[model samples]
Target: MTLPSYFLDNPYNVEGTEVVGNKLSPENELIEYFVQFRNDDLLDTLNTFEFNLEINENLILQKTLMENKDSFRNILRDAITMGTILLNFDRDDMVNINLQGKRLRNNIKINLEVPSNITLKELTASDYEGDVVTFEAKVSYWSKKRTITHMADYKCPDCGDIITRPFKSKIKDRCVEDKVFYEFFKPNISEDTRRITLREISDDFSEGKLPVSISADVYGKTVWEIELSDKVIVTGVFRSIPLRMENGKISQEFIPTIQVISVQNMKTDKMELPDMELMKKFQDLEAEGKLVEAVIDGFAYNIYKKRNEKKAILCSLIGSIWIGQVGKGNPPMIHILFVGDPDTFKSTIMKYVINVSDNCVLADSTTVSNAGIKAIAIKSDDGRWSIRAGLLPEYHGGVVFLDEFGDLKSDIYADLKAPMIDGWVSKHVAGEDFNGRAETGILASMNPTDGVYDDSKSILENLSVLKKPLITRFDLITKFSIDFNNAYDTQIGEHFDKCDFEGKPESFLKDEEIKLFINYVKTIT
Candidate 1:
């Protein structure tokens, strides 16, 4: 067949191709020539096409796109034409095609219609430009059918306005009440799901407090309820639209509702008095010459009763004044002096008292000076200045157990005179001034001069060995005598032995009772 003039005029044809005599008509000849040429070209192209373009398949396309840009463009154009034709023609069928020797470097949009039988798991997108770009997409598929209904009712406590709306899940449900309009979207509910009503109480509107009760149910079975105060507000849904509150004038965003938890006020009862039996037992122990042991045993009980009775004080005297009372007319600072020979249980008792007391200070002559009790100023990391109780301040309402009292320098002893009597310590350390009253007792134990008590020596003479002012500071002074005479020694030893052998030994009262007593004294003081 002869080629048509139009075929030769086609731009895709060579730039200067002449037309021969037309064997067919103008229109029919153009169609026939184009078909023949296209058939021939396609046959020749298919025959020569190399399925294996490069030995390295991965490098073939990348190399072609970079080295021969025109070829890459031609391949891309052909791919797009092919894709459009396939999409428009076989719109319901799935077709796969691969573009060879081509590179993609821009965004591409695609619309997919999910099959009714297929469920969508996830959706994602990738950018060929390697730049951050956000793309939004959604999945559409047929889902199991169900019904959902939303019934909303709200009351304005202040305005006395009531609004109610009924919405059905199958179609559009709109309601207008109290001069306000609402559009509700019904959610798909499964067979196992049920509808619930929630009420939210908030303090956002009225200043008055509201009493709210909250309850929950599953499948018509009640689960729990809580009583909440008006200060709290609840606003989230379980699988449907949750209860919400609006200020009658404006339509606010929906908020989930919450249940309030109620609390009960607890009343503390007064402690009851000890029975007569307990008191009689303590009295019997005291009468049997076990006063110290009895006191230790009943110390906690006594202090508790005494405290409830509002007694004056509870004091514990160990190596030094290990405990005292705090009240009006009580001294702010109490200086306790321990002046005795080594291994006299003075230091042991002082350590015990210090451990049991809430606060205590153990200082010797070196740590303390004539200046006064050293009060260290401590500033917390949070920028708060805390007057940390030093040995004296720490033991302010407790005891300051002083060991080696006689060993203290004369000047230091003299400095303690005023604090011991007046209960005040004036400290001037690092140019910082601290003056406070410490209401504590001074229970001091002193050894007689020469390490033994001399009966012939007068009380004034014995105390003269110490500073005059220091000696006069003590309220009661007693000397512990170690009698060398066998009669007196045996009598005491046999008595203690009988007590240990016949009754509960004094040593048995060493655990919780003694600890409770020490703690009780410190706490009350």
Candidate 2:
């Protein structure tokens, strides 16, 4: 029999048994009583006390019930607790379930693994943060290809001569025309032939199966050795003859010769020379001072941290200009003027840089007056033209240390104008245009006009050595001063005592330190 008309005709009823009752229905009193009774039964079955209706639209509830009538109530309750379904039972026609923001948590985790073979290079804190920091590091690993010495032993079958030699081969000919004819009476033909010929082969031939040894040493360590059969054939053109005479009579003669032949199949193998082991030995030797290592240790502590303020400034400025010119491939000639107090290290650093560099000259400005740092015309006994390089020209690829730079005569100062900028100094001495380019870095030092530098006045104003064009050529200018407040007499006394105890000569401080500093600078470049 069909159920009651109310139950069957209810639009919210999805199936025969499962029915969703709407709160906004006109028969709310009856629906509420039925819902309350059903909730009580569900609480008893599940052993839970609280139960609340997550009210949803009537049509959506009806549709969900229709799709899964058997599990409709359980599904509805789970959806409400998980926040996956939005509900509104007040309006029947607008009811709809949106399944967009649904998520579930399970037993899952993510991990990333890096391979062992991949190595990081130049890794530092600055790399991660993109900043610059100062630090020192040693060269960890270095690889360089070096020439390997090889020797071979072979006998010439045709000459019946035993020849042991070091051999090297090169491609001497390529594909060529086979008996080609130039005249119309003959036909021309070509053949492909790639051949190699021995260019050099060493000489060492001794009879019998003697103990032949071959060894290769890399960085003073033997890495490879091989002993081969004595019957190997040698191929090459003979350039020399080895002969023996008994009692002025010819007994035997060994003639060396070469013949073109093809090597059927060639095989090659490589042996890694012992490097790590030899490096360890070098390290041990370095520790014992038998080998020198590039490490700055006690040197820094023993050497005083003396700074030549003027020289440092000059180097920095000139270094910048030099680097700029190197970039443009048009480096300029440098001229500097240093007017400062006496006893300063003006000439010290100048001489230091000159000795350490590739080519340089140190001279007083007064000595280079008439010639102007370039050759002048001079008649020879044979009356032929001859040109000689002046002091500046001789200093190519290096620096010229000028002492007493501003002490030169005024006329000689004008001669420096062109060379300082254009790198050419010209003079009409001896009826010739004695012109030469001064492709050198200039470091000139001089004393101040009043014998001491004055900090109150500008450096350019105090030093009269710098004039308009000459002053502009300088990249930097600095003044040196001695501090009066921190004058410690005890320090000087201690230095004197140390010098006496060490039995150091009078010129020890000046000459020794300068020599050491020059040697150190030489290694850097």
Candidate 3:
């Protein structure tokens, strides 16, 4: 196949006729220079272009290659396009190349300053006009694919001229000589699409703020690789789509949309401890039979004196942390419910767990629904079903603190019974089925109906909302009450008087140390 004139540094215009004294574009110049001066290098580059990486000091590609980065990039891009032409690879534009070609490539990545990964808060509306950027986010929801024009091939009957025009580009559409309508127009389109909603996530939950999400359109080769809840690092151009008015007029408002260029699945396949030195320390503690105590000291550093509750939470945390290790059949998922009186540290303990948890979700029972706690497929305005997985399935391997568990709706109890009893959530909505392993542990809490525990009432009677069958799902049931004990009251009084509540005590273990240990346990698991 003959290469297009524009594909080389030829002075041939759109008319396929040679033009004299026209200034060559950077790509044209680079291509001509490469083929003439560095034919071997150019050919080698074309062959191994897919494996190219960041212009680093390697034995083959020298440091001088990065000198004229823009020019070199132009050459590489030209070579890649030529390779595409040779291999009959599908590509839309420079922004959207065959991602399979960029598997381990570094040259294209150098175009954008990555780790330029800004949070949704920092990525302002005004920043849409900027260059390519990177965002590390979780794929929250993915919509169905739709076809779009990649390019159009047109030919003129009279002049016998043909020209290829990319979609949304100002390239030669009709024959340059005829300047007439095409004799034949064949629009090349692709249905390779993965439209996803990316939500801003932080382990701290950003102190309980509304999550900022952006709708991203993944195309080309990376579409099929992405899945729901997959943590991905995306590098793309931020293109704002004009919102249409109800009256069909284009509104002034624009939608936040990203035309994804590359999607690097950053999901951790295995938990790994960062500190090797700390592993030895943990081993020493374990050998001395003080590991559990150390973990408790670290985990309950902020608390005054709630040993039983702390140990219970710790046990559940350990179980949730290592739950992924279990193979075959169902895992022994640990669920805990802390029923307590009002004006106690129930919420405090939940908050502490939230702070410590890496993949934990804190749900106020008043605001939660079956949709929010589990996966449910809902039909959108377009009549297409889209799966919206709740916090439980979304944070599958993690734990969820269902605060104010007493206030949980009665219907939610029946819905959760199956998932709790058998570690799985099956939701079939309007012919849409979503069955996933619900391995998430629920660290839930409840307060008494009268704001004080009554000795006259049974556990189920105190919280009328909590049914017996649903309550049985929990392996541990701990009670938080102000018992009128002399020694307990003295300890509480002493803690209230002496504890500064300023900085963490020197004797207390740090959260990182505990996290490292847990991660270490996961490595072994």
Candidate 4:
């Protein structure tokens, strides 16, 4: 019952040992082997039709099967249908072929890996219509994993008639005889299906734009394996289905979903590195001259003075480029605190830093909580508790701007101590540990207790409202004072009024050069 030598000798043969130039077998080699084995058994397997073929994930885990997954799937489909026809059995009587694709390891080798390189904001239906696309993003949310009935056989409750249907068919479950109909009960045998949702890793969106929600559906063997909060690179088909409406009106809106084929967790190393060209350009700027000054001027072009403070902010932006392992063995990440009087542009500078940096997070100190600062464990609708990363971990390896710093409660300040000093934050919930490795620089600002810098009191005395443990964590602490009584305020106000009367203010850097400066600062290590 073995395959003939002449059949295996052809260059286009599926199970051939040698492949000729430009000729690829349309059939999977391992699947062809399975077909031969089935034929040699001489057992009437198709006549039994008792769902005996168990071609589940374990068979696909074989090296030969994985290497030829696509061709193997087609071969498996053809073999099942052709076998049923030859045995004079109904194709519908055969068991479902389960090819669990996700059971393959996250780093499984695939021939084609498309790097879409397009942001979630830019994705459109027409751009990649009917094609498979690949992109990398953080997992924003995970829906409850549930087994869905794909196909089933049900028996009539009254007449004892049996009927087969796909899962959730709109057709009524009824048996009819002589124009009389009776309802059917639940299925005795059924198949399984699975689904999940994948979303973009974005928090900020353009004004008036809705968030993107992408769902992925898996069947049989591809079910299970993905976890919440994992950073993944996914290859999937981009398609859309009509949104379900309450009134049943045919609305033009459609929900976007990616039919995922393969996925892998993204490598965490070099997550902070910029593109090579951007790195070279940043290096060239450093090699030239005044790289630090150029970045400072670009931070807030409208403001004047505060070079020393700007330099400290610069360190917070770039942080330290450390090698080897972290923890106590590495230099601590830089943190800066601005203690200033009202109307001195503390909030203004913080906003500018957030805008200029690529991976920055801006949080108002008055509104944040201890759990919100670190990580929070949330329970899903299905009662599964998962840890959702908070603001600090979301912007790791970048800058965090905390404004209105004086309003933070002391207890909330206590929670931030470890992350600021040790470069990691942890949350423990239900015996499960979730850790956020945050190598982020902190840029926080506070107002004087009296709302104005008290000239009569010493510097430390004016800042005594803040806890000493938190204060000591800052690498640089400075006070920004403004001459409120001086006539310069009046002159500046008058100048601003005149400028508004016209159309524009006096500008130094061109818009193009300002953008270049922002990009340069963002590329810094």
* Candidate 2 structure lDDT: 0.36
Candidate 1 local lDDT, 1-525, one digit each (tens): 122111122222232222346332232322233234334432233233311122123433344344433233233223332323222333323222122111111111111111121111111112111111111111000111223333334444344454444333222322333333333332221111121222222111112232132221111011111111101111111111223345654333322211111111111112122346644644576688764544443333211122211111124332223244533254444333444444444344444444333334455444444213434443322222423223343234455555456656665566566666655567653234656555455545556667765678776675556866677776545444444588865675675566566664453343334444444333344
- List model 2 lDDT by residue over 283-321, tens digit each: 565677743222221112122223444335234223323
The better-scoring model by TM-score among 2 and 4 is 4
Q: Give the TM-score of candidate 4.
A: 0.56
Root-mean-square deviation of every model:
34.0, 35.6, 7.0, 12.2
TM-score of each: 0.34, 0.35, 0.74, 0.56
Candidate 1 residue runs with Cα over 4 Å from true position: 1-293, 297-314, 317-356, 366-372, 376-390, 487-510, 517-525
Q: Which lDDT tens digits does candidate 3 get at residues 430-469? A: 3556666667778888787777788799887776666778
User: Global CA lDDT of candidate 1, please?
Assistant: 0.35
When 1 and 2 are scored with lDDT, the better candidate is 2
Kindly indicate the candidate among 1 and 4 with the higher TM-score. Answer: 4
Model 4 Cα shift for residue 506 (angstroms): 13
Native-to-model Cα distance after best TM-score fit, residue 181 in candidate 4, in Å: 28
Better of 2 and 3 by TM-score: 3
How do the candidates rank by TM-score, highest first? 3, 4, 2, 1
lDDT of 4 at 258: 68
| Deviating ranges (above 4 Å) for candidate 2 | 1-304, 308-337, 378-387, 425-435, 485-525
Model 4 spans with C-alpha error above 4 angstroms: 1-136, 141-259, 263-291, 321-325, 329-332, 409-411, 458-461, 485-487, 490-525
